[model samples]
Target: MRPSDRVTLEDVARAAGVSRATASRVVRGDTGVTAKKTKAVQAAVASLGYIPNSAARALVSRRTGTVAVVIPEPDQMIFSDPFLTQTVQEISRDLDEADIQLVMVFGDQSGHGRRAAKYLRNGSVDGAIVISHHRFSGQVEAIMSVQIPVVFIGRPVAQASPNSWVDLDNVSAGRLAAERLLECGARRPAIITGSLDMVAAHDRLRGFREVLGRVGIDPVLLEGAFTAESGRAAGEALAPRIESGEIDGVFASSDLMALAALEAWRDRGLRVPDDVRLVSCDNGPEAAAANPPLTSVDNPTDILGRAATDMLRAILDETWDGQPVLVPARLLVRQSC
Candidate 1:
């Protein structure tokens, strides 16, 4: 029998009828394994649902007096995204308290993960904090090669992602947004989701779907790249549907997206809460500053950032008990809905 979230490499090896070393070689992308054994290992992994543990990859106890904060995004995004900046700031503030230096690494577009991986493999830092990892970016493989104490700001979209992380209850946040829309007596509701490559975005979408499904409202789903440009694009796309009365309410994935939707609707001469209603996630200053004031789900970034740092520090100190922290998100209702 296979265990969930605790499947070990050794178990996979035994199930595959190969030596543990051989299984390790395959998992690490070693090309030395024979074709017959490689097929067996693949079948075993799929049947048993084996999840690779990053913490077990040649974990070495070392102190480098520094920690790396890796953001897998371009410089322009680093400068514009308040969420990313706040995450780094909270981590930096916490690290400064313990006299640890923070080295910011930008793992940007195409092949940047490899460069980031190369720097990390040099054993230059005691630990690392990874944020905004995407699917197929190869960032997961890159970070796993380091063997340092690493923590993720959000769970990566990979089966081999490290288990340790502190994050908001995004499902609850999505449900809060959907509930707010329904409470306002909206007849036709829709959702604008963030990039599905991130686990938080998927969780938020799932929660929204679950809540709306229970009430017989099949929401119109729109995807966004978690950027202002994408948000504006989504808003423009929704304008036509709003005019046809096909979408009378919206659950935007972020405050920025919600504000963009407000602008789009206003430009179309539609009044919020009268012609359409809007609720958003990531309650921030912009939400409060909107013309009608947006109702939003608050995923406290400060709590998540500090909690992740605290978990990383505990891992560094050998005092961690291996429990994950899940901070609940709350809705801040305003006039927009």
Candidate 2:
């Protein structure tokens, strides 16, 4: 084809000596094709410089070949968190590998999530992969109202019937943290929790408390907003107790919060692992950057992202059987513990 001339699937089919249907199937990356025909179509495509028309393909296939990765947080919060960035990047890569496009949507508290839900409902994309949707976000309701498939990166706080989710087993993570603290002989342990509105926070706390309860120990629980400020406040609140030999270990729900806790302890002249051992979740970059490298739970967030995308793809392809998938979490020990 000459410059400014578009190469069509018909031209590719003719060049490969195959029917247009076969050429289209190859272009769509469908299965059940003979190796011989596949090679011929690919070779013809390379020789003819054929670039598939996305609009025309969508019209013929009734699929937009795109998916959305929705984060129900403000743009700043979404971008600032390293975990979210990683999740988006991994999801994009996985979708791209499947010959699909990724559309990122930052769903702010100010109705941005609902707007995104509307866009999804309008057939703008095939499916969506939503992350960190809280009970109060109202995005869940909007998502449930839409016909398109949605796969959540983390378990949504509220249940919308017949939804698919891919998440690390938060309950297992909590249980493991509790076991580690116990094994380390940490008495009078406490927890600085993430936002209670999030299901993850609830699951982790439940598992932590359940394990502690079995040992006849009740942990001191403090509410936190999953922010450094909240972590600092909780740390300050517990500092007095820690100093008096009352609380000796802590599990903060996030690495950022754990780092802030370290700061509060330092201000009070308390040293980590020496004075009070610590473990946290979401083993992000901050875990290693702390003065003493923090022990944290690796939630396999990238795997969660990949699983969510794959689930959405299956649903879009009418192959998913409506089962939820849970990836595992593990503890990475460091000086903080």
Candidate 3:
């Protein structure tokens, strides 16, 4: 074919010795095509330099071959948290494997949520994966109001969730942290938790409290923003209690917070596991970098990301049966405990 001439699907079908429908099905990634015919179609596409015009294909398929990754958090929070970065990267890679484009949107802050909701409602993408949405943010309400297929990366914070979601077993993770603290002989334990607006945070705190109560330990609770600074503040608040022998163990809901607590203890000349044992969630690099290496719970953010992407794909494919995916978490013991 001349450089000025466009190679159409029918041209490729003729070159591959297959019908146009068979070629179209292969290009659309539909299954049930024989391996020999599929190979021929691919070879013909390569030789003919055939390109599927996405705009034309969308007209017939009603799919844009694009999806939105909506992060309902401030830009600073997204950049500061490694879990968020890891999850986004995984989701992007998974979507890439499916030959789909990712359109990222920061939904929190100012009128971002409203604009994103409007864009999605306009059928700009086939579906969306919303992450870290809060109940009061009005973002979840906006997304749910749209007609697009949606999947959440965390437990939906809205009162009435209409879509499937993928989340870690946060309650179980909290219990695991609690058990690790107790096993290390931490009698008076305190918990530093993430924001309560998030269902994940609430579930983690609830699980931690339940397990501590079973052992007759009334844990001290501290609200944290899942930031290093918040962890430092919580640590400073507990310093006096640590000296008074009122608090001997700590469970920071996030690895960053746990590391901050470690630094705070170090500043007070307290030895880890000797004076206070600590455990946290999210087995991130910060956990491994602690002076004594903090023992932490594995949050499995990567798995959650892939699961969310898969769920969204299923929804768009019309094969979803309205079931949510719940990934599990585990504990990683280290010297801090």
Q: For this target, which candidate reaches the highest TM-score against the unseen true structure?
A: 3
In the range 1-337, model 1's lDDT, one tens digit per residue, is 6344578888889999999989988876668899999999988888888876655553632466688999887788787766788778889999999767899988855884888877887878888888887775666877777777788887665656667877888999888888888888886888888888877789999999888899898999899877777778898999898889989999888887778778877888988988889998888777888889989898677887898889998898778888878888899999989
TM-score of each: 0.79, 0.93, 0.94
Spell out the clash pairs found in candidate 2: none
Weakest 10 consecutive residues, lDDT, candidate 3?
A: 107-116
Candidates, ranked, TM-score: 3, 2, 1
What does the lDDT come to for candidate 1?
0.83
Top lDDT hit:
3
Candidate 3: list runs displaced more than 4 Å: 109-112
Root mean square deviation (Cα) for candidate 1: 16.1
In model 1, which runs have C-alpha deviations exceeding 4 angstroms? 1-62
Which stretches of model 2 miss by more than 4 angstroms?
Answer: 1-5, 108-113, 157-159
Task: Kindly give the number of clashing pairs for every candidate.
Answer: 0, 0, 0
Lowest summed lDDT across 10 adjacent residues in model 1 is found at: 54-63
TM-score of 2: 0.93
**Local distance difference test values of all predictions, in order:** 0.83, 0.85, 0.87
